[model samples]
Target: MTAARAWWARIPDPVVDLVVVAVAVVDVLVSLEDSSRLAQAMAALACAALLARRRFPLPVFLLTLPASLMLDIVFAPFAALFTLAERSRDRRLLVVCAVLFAVASATPWPLDDLSSHDRTWTLVYFFYTLATAAAPVLLGQLVQARRDLARRLEEIEEAREHERLLHSQAVLARERAQLAREMHDVVSHQVSLIAVQAGALQVAARDPDFKEGARTIRSLSVDTLDELRHMVTLLRASGGRATELTPQPTLADLHKLVTTSGIDAELTGELPPDVSTTAQRTIYRTVQEALTNVRKHAPGATAVVRLWHADDGDAFGVTVTNTPPARPSLPLPGSRQGLIGLRERAELLDGTFASGPTGEGGYEVTLHIPTQSG
Candidate 1:
């Protein structure tokens, strides 16, 4: 039943008016009962005036009133009264239209007849007149009330949905801050200790190869510690001076990032002459994520990083592709959230991201981002 009513509601007003006109025409034809042709035509025309009721309720009601005296179709005045009452919130207009409908519908029956009849019959006719006139206006009022209620309910539901989303975001934010603190307090400290031990070993070792290896480990550990601290600061500050709190790596920093990944990375192309910090950061993260995946999943592979202006200089593009691992090695532990974060970052900028095997048993990640110019 609801589905059917919803479908009916979808019908346009003009189509609804046409359907009503057809029903009114059929009603007039059925009740002809020896009425003159002119009377029938006037009745049909009065019913047709219902189409204009929405646009000009009072004018159409005035048009349909006298025609009711000829054909005596109750609905013509009733429909007009309904429309007038529904369209206006003005009590005076509604009352005036209701009185007009009563007068129009009860015509050809003398008001003085009430005085000649018994009290019982007089009361019956009086109630009948008032009831017929009031029914349409009352129905219109009911419909208006339902519509207002529905609108308010929708608004309240929307507000609730907004509040729920905000609450979820708040909870997620708190959890992220807590996680950042843990990483800094526990994991970063441990890594720094390891780096310090490697530095001590590098200083004391006699063999040049052992010293070189220790120095490499210490350098990598120190870089990791610095990045971890930067991340924690970023999370703690949240909305306040993020870039100032911890510097975000831009395209200019790709050389150092590639070097840290322990892979021979070839970088090409340039960012737009004047790019936004956001676009630059997104581009940097995309490359960073791709490089991290390589180090974790395919540690010994060489990578190629490419950057180019796409879409006629309206957008920037980055491509990172690496060959499969050189030989078997211990798999690096990872939660593998880097690629997902990279994808989300691209989407936030209305950009595109894709990563998959290159059909050569090699993995490739590609990103396209819009620059400030576009």
Candidate 2:
């Protein structure tokens, strides 16, 4: 199939015409009478006219028609050979060939001093021969048309498949980015809390309450390490196996997060279970990231976190604010990723999140999430 298609790609109309004319000239020479050289010469010229079929199909037909008519009168048996060379791109050329064939076949000719009945039989034979010679060219045109249509359809399907693959890749890239942001927010908040409690423990080692502070720091560190391990395992697993990891912390876990952050949080609201879960998780992460930001970038600054539910109880909000340290400068290491991850989490749940320096020289982070029932 490949070779045939390659060959067809290189085939110009002129090449087809040349091949046809060459074949017709060979047939004319072998079948025509040698004594009538003038008639043979006319037949050869008529066949040669076919070489210009691509450029001047009508003119070639007009030139060949009279020669064919003369051949039919002079050598009736050999006249059909010229009909094969009539093939051209123009449909009008076929019409000319048909008219010439009919006229040539119907014309009378003197053949070996034959009777009128024998002459009529020879005319019928010539008509049948002309029809047979035209069949292959007509069939070739039909086949070429079908091939062209098939090629176009294949190209369209290939283009559509390529577009679909590109669209799918784009969606997967976006989802992966969102996943990375979520993981960063979750782990960084836990790590920041551990660091702050450890520092406090070191500074207050001479005091009696240092033991209690040290114990708390150790517990928070262990819990954070376990959670981090589970997240890593979940990420590595394939298929349904990943679901074995502990379920994500939701609204019910907000109190634990705030307490671990060493913050006193005030919460008020009666939220639907599903909405409460989503809102609580989003708020918890936001607060965690905000506190981490404060401890690293604004040490010695106290933090406040407030959670509220709307009157209708369909929406909830959280706000975390903290004053800057005595000397404000660049943010803490990994602080940028925390806020970015929190923003992505909020957007995924169709909520709003914002964090920036407040007018009172303090940083404030806020989140609002809508609750939806299962």
Local distance difference test values of all predictions, in order: 0.75, 0.61
Of candidate 2, the 10-residue stretch with the lowest lDDT total is 73-82
Model 2 pairs whose backbones collide:
none
| lDDT against true structure, model 2 | 0.61
- Of candidate 1, the 10-residue stretch with the lowest lDDT total is 108-117
Residue-pair clashes per candidate, as listed?
0, 0
Model 1 / residue 4 / CA error / Å: 3.2
Query: How large is the C-alpha RMSD of every model relative to the true structure?
Result: 20.5, 25.4
User: What ranges in model 2 sit over 4 Å off?
Assistant: 1-20, 31-41, 72-99, 109-130, 177-374
TM-score of 2: 0.38
For model 1, how does the per-residue alpha-carbon lDDT over 153-191 read when each residue is reduced to its tens digit?
Answer: 554465467669978877876887788879988999899
For 216-329, candidate 2 gives per-residue lDDT tens digits of 776777677667656655543321232444355676776776676533344444345445445566776787678766655664467777776678766777788886553323
